[model samples]
Target: MADGRVERGNQTRRAVLARTVDIASVDGLEGLSLGKIATDLGLSKSGVFALFGSKEDLQIATVRAARAVFVERVVQPVQDEPAGLAKVWRLCESWLGYSGRRVFPGGCFFYSVSAEFDSRPGPVHDEIARIRGDWARYIERLLDEARLAGGFREAADPADVRQLAFEVMAMMELANAHSVLHGEAMDYERAARGILTRLRAATAAPEELPERPPAFDFTAGRPSA
Candidate 1:
């Protein structure tokens, strides 16, 4: 009986988390109230609270759930591919797809929460920072691998590539925000093109770059102060 109850509890927890992530992505993490989640899932307030003792716990769990979803839908697909340029391509395509497909109703979960919580210091903010740093490091490592292979110029710095990767991600997030606001997919396509163009330029030998549509340069960053 105890085991059965525990199993049921675990199932309920997962269901709540899955739904919570989607809600938190579309609505800010603070907007993810127990009342709203329970209403969405037809679960009782007490039941939701039982799973997560407090809103902070729920926020942390939601972040973890979103990360798992991202890894499954975005990272795992690329991991199976051989490392170097191919892996980097796969990774980029997967990331764009992950955002474009709306795995969460609002686009990228991290993008939503990071902006919401970046300036606010707390456990939730800390989690967002850690996730962002982890992703940047992952991109840096991938860039390092591609550079070690014949994919990138020996003169290219991994840090520069990482910065480029961050720019691409920022572009996607900016596009997503504008799309959500204006109800159009053009920005998503534009962001994808921007990413691919920079990636090809960075990775391909100068002689090997194919003629394609012109790319936007987000790596230009903020204007000099």
Candidate 2:
């Protein structure tokens, strides 16, 4: 009986965090309140507070929740693909898809929350920075893997590949903004083409490279969140 009660509590906490992440994605984390989240989820404010302790705790928890969603949606899918240039390309596609699909309703969760906490210094900011740093490192690791697989030119520098990863990040964020503000799906295609061009330039065997995948079509319907 005690185990059942503990399991129920854990489930409720997960439910709260899921909703909290969505709300934080749309409105900055600063906009979150225990009372508001409790009301939205039909739970008691005290119950919510009991789980998170304070607003900062809740904000940090929300960021953690978002990171889980990001990994499931963006990272794991590409990891399932074979490593090398293909994996790297798919990683770029999945990221664009994640943002284009509006998985968080307000666009990329990290991009939105990072902008909010970037200038602020605290646990929340630190957590966001850690997430960003970890992602950058992941990109670099994929580039290194591709290099070992003979995907890139023998002369390509790891530092240069890391820089290319940063360019891909910039294009993705720009695509997200353009899609959100102007509703231009073409921005996603442009970003994909730009990434493809960059990758092709680094290709060790241009003729042996796989054909590029079609750009995501946002006009049809949003991908499942």
Candidate 3:
């Protein structure tokens, strides 16, 4: 009986987080309320509240859950590839694929929430900022590894890698924003082209990359979120 109760509680927590992440993506973290969530999912209000304790707690948990999904959908797939300029391309391509596929209703989960809580100083803002920073660092790390491996220019140092990573990420975020706001898929193609151009310019091994970016999925219509 105790085991069954624990399992049920675990399932409920997962269910709540799953709903919260999607809702937060579309409506922003501030849009979430335990009462509304419970009502929407047909769960007891008291039980939902008990699981999350407070609104802030629920938002934080939602961010964490979304991060897990992001890793599974984007980061892990290219993780085993040999570290080089090609791997860098693979990472960007994976990220574009995730956004292109509309893994979340609102597009990139962090992109939506970051705009909402960027100026607000709170636990939620801090959590989002931390994760965003981690992503930047990871990209820089990949670029530096490529440089060390002779895939990128040997003259490029940490600073250059940092700048390159920022530019690359900027292109991607623009694509995500354009897709979410304009409901057009052209930005994905634009981002891919921009990414390839930048990588090709930065690489020491010209033959390591393709002459052009692979085709992006352009069939997705405007996002409802």
Candidate 4:
């Protein structure tokens, strides 16, 4: 009986988090309420409240859950790829696909939530900021690794890994922003092409990346393999 009860509670928690992530992505974490989520999920308000404890706690958990989905969708695929210019390019490609395919319904979960909470001061804002910082650091680390692997040209300013990562990340965020606001993915192609140009200029192996942006069926909401 004890084991069964625990398993059921875990299932309920997962169910609540799944709904909360999608809802928070589109509406921001401040939009979440225990009562409304309980009503929508047909679960008791007290039960949902018991699992999360407070509105802020629920929002924090939702952000954490969205980060997990982001990792699985964008970061994990190229995890084992050689840590060189190719890996960096592939990682950016994954991010574009994740956004273009609407993995979060609002494009990038962090992008929407970060803009919502960027100026606000609270635990939710801190959580979002920390995760975003982690992403920036991750890109910077990849760029450093690529340089060590001799993936960059001598005259390409490979020493400025931070700037490269910054530019790449900025382009990606713009893609997500434009796609969500305009309901079109023109920015994805533009970002992809722009990034490829930057990467090629940095690396001696220009052939390692596509000459053009990867083909995508934007109407079908798919990015190329």
Estimated TM-score for each candidate = 0.85, 0.93, 0.95, 0.95
Of 2 and 4, the candidate ahead on lDDT is: 4
Error of 2 at 66 (Å): 0.6
98-125 per-residue lDDT for model 3 (tens digits) = 8877888899999999999999999999
Pitting candidate 2 against candidate 3, the one with the higher TM-score is 3
Ranking by TM-score: 4, 3, 2, 1
| Candidate achieving the largest TM-score | 4
> Clashing residue pairs, candidate 3?
183-222
Candidate 2 lDDT trough over 10 residues, lowest sum: 216-225
Give one digit per residue, the lDDT tens place, for model 2 in 82-162. 657767877888888888878888888889999999999999999999999999899989988888777886677788888
Candidate 3: residue 92 Cα off by (Å): 0.5
What does the lDDT come to for candidate 4?
0.89
Steric collisions counted per model: 0, 0, 1, 0
Candidate 1 has a TM-score of 0.85
Point out where model 3 deviates above 4 Å.
218-225
Off by over 4 Å in 2: 207-213, 219-225
Q: lDDT of all predictions, in order shown?
A: 0.76, 0.84, 0.90, 0.89
What residue runs in model 4 are displaced by over 4 Å at the alpha carbon? 155-159, 218-222
